[model samples]
Target: MTKINAFTYQPLTIPSHTESVSKQNQKPNAQKSSFSESLEEEYEKLPLKLSKHARERIDERDIHISQTEWNLIHSKMQEAKKMGINDSLVLTKDAALVVNMPNQTVITAMGLEEANTRIFSNINGTIVINH
Candidate 1:
């Protein structure tokens, strides 16, 4: 039993409806980040090796890809995998790359100027990215 006015006032406790919704939202986001991170780690462990010919082309062409461009290329390749693509021609703002998807190898690379002038053939898929 309890007295209404004899002691200090008390209030009833309740939970907000948004509390559960917010928790559910956080869970999926956390899982997605963890899953992606693990996938990247596994990918990094396996070499995304560049062929000797590709290296020579990069050196001769003087094409430089920044870290951001590299990450974008990495992600685009993952997307290509889902689309049943093997050899891909990736056209980026700064550079063009020919990637062998299964082996995660870079077959060749060149600057945009070179790519624009030349025709890319024998590629199963083409990927375009901002940078």
Candidate 2:
């Protein structure tokens, strides 16, 4: 019987000249993989959480929020809280969001275009975010 050497195949990969400098040039933990992660972090820092009704309303209304918007809202909410405001009318260029600051959840949301010229009462405070 003829005996041959055991076969071991190695695939060729062209070597890359990338240096360790590439690693240094990159910022540590610079990228976030998901929006949920950052949102969770922000939620943790703030004692705020969305109500089921609020969440449903957002979905039903197809209201979307960016990270920047959320940050702005959080800041405004903090201000409202300090001023002893409970339900706050938050007016942004794109959205009219009602947030229950004490409850730490958004009550409902509407498009600015739709909410334009509409009156909102019973809110102890109103925050108009320009730009």
TM-score for each candidate, following the candidate numbering: 0.61, 0.58
Q: Candidate 2 lDDT, tens digit per residue, 1-131?
A: 33358766666665474566576556443554355567556545544576667666666777777767778888889988998999888888778888888777887778788788789877888889877
Off by over 4 Å in 2: 1-47
Candidate maximizing lDDT: 1
Residues 1-131, model 1: lDDT tens digits: 45677875657657578788889989988999998788456435534667778877876887777666777787889889889999999988878899999988999999988788998888899999973
Judge candidate 2 against the unseen true structure and give its global Cα lDDT, from 0 to 1: 0.75
lDDT, candidate 2, residue 117? 76
lDDT of 2 at 70: 79
TM-score of 1: 0.61
| Regions more than 4 Å wrong, model 1 | 1-47
Winning model by TM-score: 1
The global C-alpha lDDT for each of the candidates, from Candidate 1 onward, is: 0.82, 0.75
